[model samples]
Target chain A: MDVLLVEDDYYLADDTRRVLAAAGANVAGPYARVAESLSRVAQGRVDCGVLDINLGEGPSFIMARALKQRDVPFVFATGYGREVLPDDFNEVELLEKPVDPRLLIDAVARACRKHETSEV
Target chain B: MATLAGAMNGPGADRLSALPWEQTPLGPRAGWPGSLRAAIDLMLGAGAPCALFIGPQLVQMHNLAFDALYRDGSAATRALGRSLKRDDPDSSLAKAAGEVFAGRSILLASQGWTIGASPGTPAFNLSCAPIRDESGQVGAMLVLAFPVTSPARLDAGASISELQHRVRNLLAVVRSLVARSAESSDTVEDLAAHLDGRIAAVARVQGVLLRNPHAGVDLEGMIRDELLTQSADQDRLNLGGPEIVLPPKAADLMTLAIHELATNATKFGALSQASGKLDITWKLDQAGARGQQLELVWMELGVAIASQAPRRQGFGTNLLKRRLPYELSGEADIEFRPGGVVCRIAFPLAPVAAMGSSSVWGVTTTAGDDA
Candidate 1:
């Protein structure tokens, strides 16, 4: 499974990539901004993704919406609670920060599992 | 006015008499109308802070409590018996007084008023009611001024500053966690696991605190939250305890401690296996002098453990034993048994009433609980 990780914090992003890599998922660019991450999501062969809702500039709801349009499964990793998320993304998996490493790995795996099950 | 003779007996009566009323448009007190005299009497008699701007000239007559509003040297003395138009023309009090003079009774709430040359502009909730004479005309305007800003505003400002300070401290804590985790891990994967676990612990604490900002954190709820984050199988974990509210300081420290324990269990302790079991129980030792002391025990069962403890102390051990003790004034005993890890923590609970009455004690699990 190839996972795209979008997070603004460099340290947290690096850590997340490492966790996913260890969990046997092929990790893509750990993009630091919405524009870069959005382009990566468009260009890369991403199976699923882990997204941070707040990208320092604004929310990543647009990214989530874009992924949803492409029928992609993704999980939100945020410091803020679910109340800040849009109504449309309510069914999307949310992982509150600091995300437990086990939970993070499990969520990305689950996202991939859901995608695979749906495709079959 | 009725010769200012017997009327000079109430509060602020001496100040009222001492003022140069003869120099104002209302002229001497001896020649003032009966309505004006009655208004002055009523203003001085009240204990609460209030002022009366009498007649069309809007002359000022306030009580003793109202005097504090004009404590700036000459401003207090200069304001007495003077026309609102003549004294501080740009003030909200002057503007509100003008509206009252136009036969309108206005109640101004939390209105800012800059008194004299003072830089601090305090808020005042004032009501300007038009006092009618015997002929049914708007005779004297009775102005009631109540200081509204000091207590409430001071509290809000303090809370905001405290929140900012806490956020800065939390950020510093995150920075330290990342740096420390990097030092211990050999590979990037190891570093991510360590750093993410610690950061998640801090975030969990923040979530609990943010939910019930006024009240202390719920002990049972916090423990369950930490455990639920590590695994989806709730059947393996048995958490039983009465509702325990911990002070913010204790809650923050305990969250990290519990996280460390849970992380260790998931990796190598009870939760590492399919048939593994975990039991968390806590009770209050209410015999303490100040308040109840909480004794919590986390016992991991049905899993094989290492024969010996680690050679060196890790973050989990340091947080439970050293950090917990230093920060929350508590003690923790973590032992690696042959079966699984057993940890015991004891801390003095702050008085229930002091923890704040307005706090909602609802159990708020993370988003993963539903998943």
Candidate 2:
């Protein structure tokens, strides 16, 4: 599975990227802004995504909505509470910050597998 | 201590019946104001604990329920005829009652009553209402006390949990910092230096944030402190800027970036040379599309071109060129001139403030090219 990581905080972004890469999944561009990620998502190699809501400017809900339309599953990595997410994205998986590597990988596998089985 | 017969009922009434009513500041019972008379009647008829503060002195009178609150001694009864306005003026009840006396009825969620100075005294929920005379002039205060539920303990528990959540979030960020520091280091020593310096920079910012939780760190102070520790002499630096306060997250990243730059200068740039100069300056750029932007420039001169940049494009370079842009939604430019290295960073500053006509951090044009 290919996982696209989008986060602004460099340490968390770099560290999360390492964790996802180590789990044997191909990782896409760890883009910083919405425009950058939105363009990358349009090209279509991404299977799953791990997005941080607050991208310095605003939450990545714009990207989240796009992913939803594409039928791709993803987890939200946030230091903030659930109120930060809207009602539409409430059911999506949430990964709390300083994310545990094993949990992150498992969440990705589950997200991808979830979509796969529903199709089956 | 003869037949005193106060205008009330209850143990407090019994206590008032025993006191020499005509002698104290309260004066004789019949001579009491009509407001006091009515207030006493209302307090005694209450099902819960109640106190009446009467007259200009605001002397206290209570019912059996109010007297029962202090079970150890007759302290609550003794407190009768003591002035809530004057006797224990600093007391919480007195303060609330003062408002009632001012013709405003105040219902408090919780208040401390000086029934006894003894420890483990429970807090009371007090409701103070204005008691007016027959002439419609405010003359007394009627205070009702509810059962104690130990809300202070509950509030402390909530604050502790809030504190715990914050600590855990902070720990997570630190954990990520540890891994990132390790990733950029080429060797064990490099890792230690990178980790220690980055951690210390974070600690410095954390200290400022803790001291002033609302207002953030001043940009000028950050640059001075960061470079001073790098042993860059005061005379070798030209620091200028309009005072800019960076919010917590921005402060953390900026401080780290400054640390990286200072460390590089100390090792190879201006600070390492005998006749070198380092100019650190910043200004608020108001005319940007993204509200206000703060632009900072770190320039060094008099050091050799070989040591201008770190051998590897490590933490400092990546932070200035890449991480800063991603995290701050900003821009950065790092140029290694033959004589030194120059780095310019710009980011949006929130709560766009307009100060007196902005001061220019004069660019020292003489040293940019000593090649």
Candidate 3:
């Protein structure tokens, strides 16, 4: 399974990649900003993406929209409580930080299943 | 004041010693080594009594009222002198010292007899106590005394009753400032803007201390009132929320912040143009076991805007970005869409207790403090 990890924090990105790689998922570059990560999604097909709710400038909701446009499944991770999220994004799953390995693996699996079921 | 201090300081040490309060006096003898006249002048200058030491003996003595008033000072200062074993001797000085050394406290009458060798009726308060030597034996005693003037004597005192008058004067000053600043504006828009500027001038960073008959405000309701007061025609605004009580500072700042937003909307964004409408809403959420948050939403439509984002930080931006977040323990964001500016502010609900009884003006609110 190929995954696109979109997160601004480098240390968190590295740790998340290591855990996903060890779990047998082939992850692409862990892009830092909404612009870079959305481009990677535009360029290729990825099974899933991880997003940090607040990027440097504002919300990463734009990237979530991009993922939705491309038919890729994803979840939100944020330091701010979920209450800070805008209402339109409520249907998507929310993952809290410091991302635990098992939770990340399970969320990815869930996303992949939803994607597959929706395509059907 | 002068008489009060003089009565507190003059002689009658035996009589002063019977009082139950603290008194210390100073006089010419207390200021000896300097000219006795200088000591008297110094005592009179302070309008209070001075501690006196007579001759080489340094026999301790104090007026009865002074001894009673300032027994602690007498007890502490007495250690420097010789212990007198006898009772109140007929010697006016000895009688004063005996009155001081006899007890731990005293009281003074408004009209009292004086102290000293000639026994002149100088108004003063006197007190004294025994001093102990290195061997713990009673050494010479020390006298403490002072004087107090009658209340009528003081010229500068503004009594507590004057507070209401001062408040009224302050209100008049505020009204004058507001009128002065608005002198040039003619149109309604210009007047509203001028009024807003004036309100912001005194708009404490926190909410207004409103005259709530019930004494507390419903914060949600207050925010609506603030928004409505500055809002455009009724057709253009929408508000919704369950009631929440907020202390004065939080409610004030929140009101001002929202006022700025509404003002901006009316002048530049949605409310300015026809067909524009604003929807304001709020809800409470528990972030965790320790934190609670109030999340507010502002949705606008129909107003046309050229910019998708605000290029520079205006006062409104700074208030929302820095002041609201920092002061209220909240975070806010404003986004410019083709439709209008969508703003959201989230704040921690805890710490309101420490903010004290804050009230917002022109808004009604209630809290558990009363209900």
TM-score each candidate: 0.60, 0.61, 0.34
Best by DockQ: 2
CAPRI verdict (incorrect, acceptable, medium, high) for model 2: incorrect
Candidate 1 stretches greater than 4 Å from native: A1-120, B1-10, B31-48, B67-78, B98-113, B116-152, B155-164, B207-213, B287-290, B306-311, B350-371
After superposition, candidate 3 runs with Cα above 4 Å error: A1-120, B1-195, B198-216, B307-311, B354-371
Residues B247-342 of candidate 2 have per-residue lDDT tens digits of: 666888899999988987888888888877998888888855676788999888887756745567777777777777777777899888877889
lDDT, residue A86, candidate 3: 64
DockQ of each: 0.01, 0.18, 0.01
Q: Could you tell me the lDDT of residue B161 within candidate 2?
A: 35
Give the residue spans of candidate 2 off by over 4 A. A1-4, A21-46, A53-71, A80-91, A118-120, B1-169, B286-288, B304-308, B350-371
Q: Which window of 10 residues has the lowest lDDT sum in candidate 2 chain B?
A: B352-361
Query: Residue A78, candidate 3: how far off, in angstroms?
Result: 39
Ten residues in a row with the worst lDDT in model 3 chain A?
A52-61
For all candidates in order, the CA lDDT equals 0.71, 0.73, 0.55
| Most accurate candidate by lDDT | 2
lDDT of 3 by residue, B1-371 (tens): 43334333334432333332222222323222233333323332332343433322443333333333333554533422232323224444455554444433334432433332122222344544454434544334444454434322111122121222223323433454354335545676866775665476334322344343123356656656656666567777777887776654456557666777776776677777787888888888998953668888988888776524545565567667765654455789888888888999888665432211132233322222211
Q: Report, for candidate 1, the interface RMSD.
A: 14.8
lDDT of 1 by residue, B287-365 (tens): 5563567889999888864534656688777766765554445688988888787899987664322121222334321
Q: Give fnat for candidates 1, 2 and onward, in order.
A: 0.00, 0.31, 0.00
lDDT of 2: 0.73
